[model samples]
Target: MVRSTAPLLALCACLPDPLGRCQTNTDCERGPAGSFCAENVCQGPPRGSIEALPARFFARSETVHVRTIVDRSHGEPAVHVLLGSGAVAAAREPDGAFGADLPLRFAPAGSEGPVPFAVEVKDDLGHLTLLPGSIQIDDAPPRVSVDLASIPSPAAVRGSSVPLRVVVQDLTPVTLVWTAGGAQGAAMQQPDGSFIAAIDTSKAPAGAPSLDVAFTATDAVGNASAAHASIPLTRLKFVTRHDQPIASIVVSDVIWAIAQSEIWILHRDGTSLTKGSTDATPVAEAATDGHHVFFARSDDKVCRMGSDGSIQLCCGPFTPLTGGPILLGSNPIVSTRHTATTSSRLVAVLDSNGICNQMSWLTTVDFAAAMPAVGVDGIVYSGASQAIVAAKFDGSVWTGGHPTSETPSYRGQAAIQGNSVLVSTTSATIDTFASVPLNSDAPTPTTVQAAVAGTVISSPTLAEDGTVTIATNDKRIVALKTDGNIRWNATLLDNATASPTHGAGGLVYVGTAGGEIIALSGDDGSAIWSQKVGAPVRGPLAPGCDGLLYAATDASVVALVIDAAGLADSDWPRAGHDIRGSGDARRPLRSASGACLE
Candidate 1:
């Protein structure tokens, strides 16, 4: 056995080290750390300033870790580094930059750049010295830029295609991302710098949303550029609060008001929420009893449309007059100079005794048929249907008034109240029209009396209990007993043309050319309140649907609140003109019948 001074030396001589420490006895002349004197650690000539890629290069680059210089004395030399934490370790290439052979798969993140800690110089003597700036690392993040055309494109010509382009650039490779269209579409990225996407207008509506397109571009460094641009699109149909209706026609809850042309569903608040017809042709007058709508048709047919949009006509021979008469349920009323009242399908019209023209007669049509047409010359409700009943010239051709026992002085049209026809006829005769149930009833008025003589009868209105109220053009509102006797008399702003509509608060309303709507005590006809809505009162006034009053004027529609506390005067309608477009009927289109075609 070879005598050994240390057991370690003997073991080293026996086994071959894969570390390539020593090959022959001659190699041992350098010892475990190379060349004998070096102890503990052994290393070959440290790689010369390692050539790193991305020189001091960024982006995890490969590196070269190999001996650069050889030791003539053949001593162990190892590359080492001193850490900030007072630790010592192998010294890597001066630069952490990636090298070809010794690759650095990882890159320093959030750091200035590849950072080198310290470098160590080793000698065969087993001595080491830490060099403060032995390594040079990279610092600096990449700069990126993105280009976007933020201007929104024009409205796409309904059916066409448009291109949206975006460009993203970076000091390094860049990923371009984008989102197009809506949820139906998808988002994606094109590794390339600029991307162009096609937006088919053919798939869009007329007025498609040409909203600004949004996008973002980020370089590998996580730097981003926010972008925005308007896209051009086609048009189809778009509805928004931007759209406003020109006019609305409203009437009683159960009835449709014969407004300008179209049949509009009525609301108590005077708001006509339905889409009105823009046609020039007049339709028909309908009534809503707060529920279903009853249309008084002059075609001799009574039609009804429910609030739910259901439509049907009660079958009958009742024909509407050329000019539809005032409609009550299916019944239509019209007065003739010759005194013949005809309706939609009614073959038989009631005739009165009077000379055509000067003769005035109020004839009621069958409750079964007829529809009202549009225009002011169409239907006119007689203020009261008693003596001297108000006559209408529904544009057709019924001559003047005629004489009759129905009350020659009739003015106020009769209001049908629970089984009784209350006629506040001719300011003077307050009477009730009840078919006495004959032996099956009793003795009815064998002969109806006429107005005392000369006095002209004003229109009459009635209360729930058959009390008659009549108004004379003379500005006075008179109340009468159910038996044609005067109960009380009240005055008004001016000549009253319309019938009185009673309210729940024991108040009565009437319209007058006096340019004001007067409210009077239901019983005494005493003035309770007055409001001067713009323009002279035309016929009667529609009581508010929901505590508001509605008035018709050439200026426009207006609403007024019922203030029992005496609210001050105001001009709320003026403001409405600002929001709604100033009425401009420039559109060439006429009747919805497709009549006025260009």
Candidate 2:
């Protein structure tokens, strides 16, 4: 029995020890259906194998839905699945399968790269299974932003350079898309993720409206973002400032200006006509008749210079005219005074040699003031009694006086058409526009008065169709029909200080104190186009023979090509357009239909 017991013990020892203390798998026996001996201990099948499902590549600020299957074979049902800082409860199926819908949200401050995931499975004994493996977590996308504060002003002038700036946050490439004045192009990105696009408006189409700029950013992962801005373009083709303020401007073959009390001529292309100062300082506005420039000097002398800057004529010692001299066939008709304190004014028609050939005494009671208008029949001027007076060139008084009830404070020069004399008057409380018949015998002239609401400060421009265009102090431009009826009124950008210029195709051009040149329709007074020229326009706009419109600002002269038809050909050349100061240039100077001929 001892021997048999000894052999049995030896056989039991040779077999597997039930306590299961083994150094290798060869010393241990498989215990259960889903159990295995590991590290000399019997363990259940891995708590669960977590298999990550497909997911979309997300951005840093976006959330991703993680659909994973947790398999629990020998271990108990999985309670939850953990991925990064996000977790989800595992739903156990009847087939012992565990599935979890995990929402993994990557925080801005979270780690980027591969993320480790773990699953918690509980056995029947409350033991937990933690499975760990690396899954890629790519939530990094290039950041992009627009710097609107650094953007250029919405208003830009033509032929000017506009700068654009953009800011990007990543190393991703960037591009600038720009469309200005019907022009389109693309710009490359800089090293610092910033893009700078300089747009030159001179290269834009003739009538290009505004500038539209956009920026596009693309990340390394194909992510994209965009931003946009707009800028309104102006009609100013070019601007060149002078050392001194520009007092007046006249356009002929060359552009002339009174700056620094001297005459400066500029070519059509904005180049200097003369290498240096052309003439002596002038006391008043300058006038050009396409060949010779006439000006009044500080010494009360009226002088004429050739277009090439050669002095032609200088007549002086006589009383200086209140307004500039009126040129009629190479002669100057001026309102002069024999003595400094003389109450009566004389209308002197001077010869080409500056010698007064004819003189007519104007009847006066109070302050002698008049802007004379010369026509084919006679010379018409406003008398001191606010009446219309007429005289012939031979100093013969034709119409002594045609009195009106209201005071005639003529703001702009008078305009004559056919048998009618059109004048704009502004009193203390009323703005009156009158169309008076030219009758020497009629004691009371037939006057048709068109009352305006605001003060009329600019001269009335008469069209060939007998329509009238005028600018008022209230920043308004109005058109009047033949019978003095209101056609249309449009608001101006600022105070309309300069006279409205009538262009071809029934268009009117007006300048404002706000540095804007506005074009209005002659029929309805609707705004056609507006350009901010960057300086106050104080002088009249002259339509050139070319398609360009010339204007005088505080510091420079600007040329703009506003219309395709170009400026019309009119006998009226400078301000107060004609020699009669009629301001109407719709016809030739000798035409009987409203022609101011002497």
Candidate 3:
């Protein structure tokens, strides 16, 4: 009996038939107010639809207002937003449209992209209409990064502009800005979607070790991301003073020099601290033990001066000196010869305070042309005629002579590296560079020899890689591999007046008689840059702790700015190796941070 009544009710419900039009729920329109879809026929309240809605949603907004166009044909209607969580009731606005506050509570955290939602409009007659899945949601921030490889070099010069490359990934467009060293600029986008920015270092401080560049990328909707890149920077500054400087050494940020027959102590800024008479014939540069300076006065005496400019003590007039004094521990040792050709050569050692210990002397010594080098084992090495001599102070014993070449010529300063002593000798007949082993235990401690194009006037310097860098009197700079093979050679613009010194970043610096201080790449022996002083540069380019290159020329002493914070981190970076010109390669004086010490 119930089945018979259902058949009659079904026929009455299809008064306005349209059965073929609605095959699925999607085929029906989302009507509002009174009208709804049933069997493809509108029934109950009058029809209405959602006219406007936000095209996208943001999770940070917390709530969204949805507007609907409802029909008044079915009296007053109620509007609601149906999210994945639950329904949110809507109220009529003053403009006549129904509005609903859709909270983000219905959205899962970290959810993004198109979030399907439904809108419903119901009338008093209980007829409903729906619109589903039309808006999108965005919750992700842009990905940001910096392309470090795109930076020009590890170091940037002051008052220069350097370019940086940036990368970002996001669904929306982003804007970028960069800041560094108190400078800021907008990042420009390239055709390939990468961004580029140029950093101006005009106002950046010259002494800072590096400049840090930061970038921030923001999307259209206020979601932001950040990235950073750091680049080392170099600022060039030159300080010149006409102090009549000759040879100089840097100790603890102070400059000590033999200037115009006087011992001058100066600040790195060229300000004179004190000056004292040196008996009119100050024969050598000053040496220090980090607190006091030792010098040779014309009276054939070894005098010690405190760093405060006062003479500490004076040792008795020793034999006529030939080269500058050097230190082994606290003792100031000097080289003396009665005459150039005479075999009457003496190596005298004096205690810390001016006390002479006639304990060590060599009668067979034929020549001592340059300052001697001391080994870590307290062995003093010098170049004698045709040989390299080693003398130890412990027992007043000499290691005898290790002959270098068959030719008898005076050798300049010696640079000791590891167990070997490197010496260069030049004469009318032959010019030789030798690396002789100090250890006598080897069956045949073969002397490694490398031929040079011309006379080597200064000691050889060792690169960090153990390559030997030397300057020749013939205006040439040469580098030799560890095996004594020629690595590279560079012909200088003029004859080198002093030894070549190593600087940070694999650079070699040398001064020339032409008044030009030149810098060369240690790796390839290529010219980097050269600055000309008004006078002949007479000595090594001294690297100071204040990031300045101190050069003593014939006319004036000048401080040239460099890109290094301190000296090069190499075995034998400079002539005489350290700032003191100690010539001891095995134990170059250095601070705990590896910076050269006085």
Candidate 4:
């Protein structure tokens, strides 16, 4: 009984008590490396407290190195960087601080403002803590732009204060610099993110035939942009004609000026030769075949005179015409209003021995007020119906169907090239330059159409290469290929009312309502030169063989000498300078000498 009791006592002593040993963290202080007393057991230190150095700042394409100090009383802590949803482990430094490189680009692309980040610390016992922080992002640089208005005129006179305007755009304050004559100028900013600067040409260098102006614009972020322009300077020669506005001008061996009811001839030296008068009526316009000048009186009487102002022949009083007595192979084709009530008629008055032989007419509907363009095979004109009608000299006529179905309003005069006819039309529903084949038998001619942005206000001038030049009411001069493709365009300061004329050396001349004549390169539409005539020009430019450009303004006739070598002794004997009113003089007229009359 004693031996059994002793074994029971030993077993009872070996059994442990039911009460736990630890209740708080302080009770198990001397345990493992990261041990802490919790839940009646020793454990590691609580997740270390993370403190970031220099909490937050802005970054632009810069690396943000985050240094954090983690406090873990019981053991060292593992540190990491939380950028958005991604985590990057940090390296511990010799000073006991944790660091991680956070590139600003790590943020979302094109992101701005504060980017959230955190320094996280974890202990060996799996406890975690986070330190919240942020960084502002602004890495984009400011943009800059520059523009120059009216830098190059066709011709700028020396000592003239040519007006120049410069415009700049930038989000922040911009520094603008411009050089005119080593003289720098600054621009003032406007509320609409634009700056304006004016350049005075009077301060340019002496004897400078050309002026080169350079401009630079710098933004707040050190971004810069630049631009430049060139201007040509020349001397001007002016010729005055009648006191009243010169209605029309034609240059040959002599310059002819039509005003009121008389035609006066002026030599190159601006001397008046002789004056001829229409039979008590105003003439529409005159034409020349380099031998004789012919014009139609308002009373339907067609008169002919020599280039020297000698009266040749006068025949007509037949049918009343709206405009033109265009000479086709010495025969006159007039756009006549048959009776007081009829639409219109294109009458061909046949002449032999300077006498009217037989008069034949082509009846038309909706005939335009302008003259018909004469081709080798036929005559083309815009009908009142918005259709283009071509009347062959053999009495056969072909019509191009209406270009637009909505309304038919035609602008400018028709131009005939071989079997093709070019015309401009603008209506509420259509504004286009159409090339129609005159020989086509289709009821509605299939035309190559080029859309125009503005109302064409002048007759189309056909070039030697079949290109067509037309001026719009919006001051734009456009050139088109025979296939209706745009060749080039030039914008003027004011509306261009005069038709463009071709000259020697691939040059195209156009006159503006602002009294300015501009010469453009036919190849690329670049400005070759420009001149201000000081009066409104409403007539086409006539190129003389003397290398001079003859144009009539509101008050006088201007003969501009552009290229001396280009003068070819050609005669501008008529308004359009040719039988077809083509405004192209391909052959030199024998009547004029090689010497410049002016």
lDDT of 4 by residue, 136-230 (tens): 65433334334434655566754455555556644445687777777678766667656565656555553455777777877553456777766
Top lDDT prediction, candidate number: 3
**Local distance difference test scores for all models:** 0.39, 0.58, 0.67, 0.60
Error of 2 at 430 (Å): 10
Model 2 CA deviation exceeding 4 Å by range: 1-208, 211-234, 275-285, 336-343, 349-369, 376-385, 394-409, 428-439, 442-456, 565-575, 578-598
Candidate 3 per-residue lDDT over residues 250-289, each given as its tens digit? 4545677766677677776777777766655566455677
The TM-scores of all predictions, comma-separated, are 0.36, 0.55, 0.59, 0.51
Badly placed stretches (over 4 Å) of model 3 are: 1-240, 297-299, 316-319, 338-343, 351-360, 395-406, 427-457, 532-534, 544-546, 586-598
Ordered by lDDT, highest first, the candidates read 3, 4, 2, 1
Q: Model 1 segments beyond 4 Å from truth?
A: 1-257, 264-272, 275-286, 289-412, 416-419, 424-428, 438-443, 446-459, 464-466, 482-484, 553-556, 563-598
lDDT of 1 by residue, 373-492 (tens): 111222222322222221234324443222123432333233433333333333344454442221123113222222343444443444545555656656677666655567777866
Question: Could you tell me the TM-score of candidate 3?
Answer: 0.59
**Tens-digit lDDT string for candidate 2 (192-299):** 757666777666554458656655656543556666766567666678777777766766667777676667778887877762243456643556667767666655
In model 4, the runs with Cα more than 4 Å from the true position are: 1-235, 280-284, 307-312, 318-320, 337-343, 350-358, 378-384, 394-411, 428-454, 464-466, 481-483, 564-598
lDDT of 1: 0.39
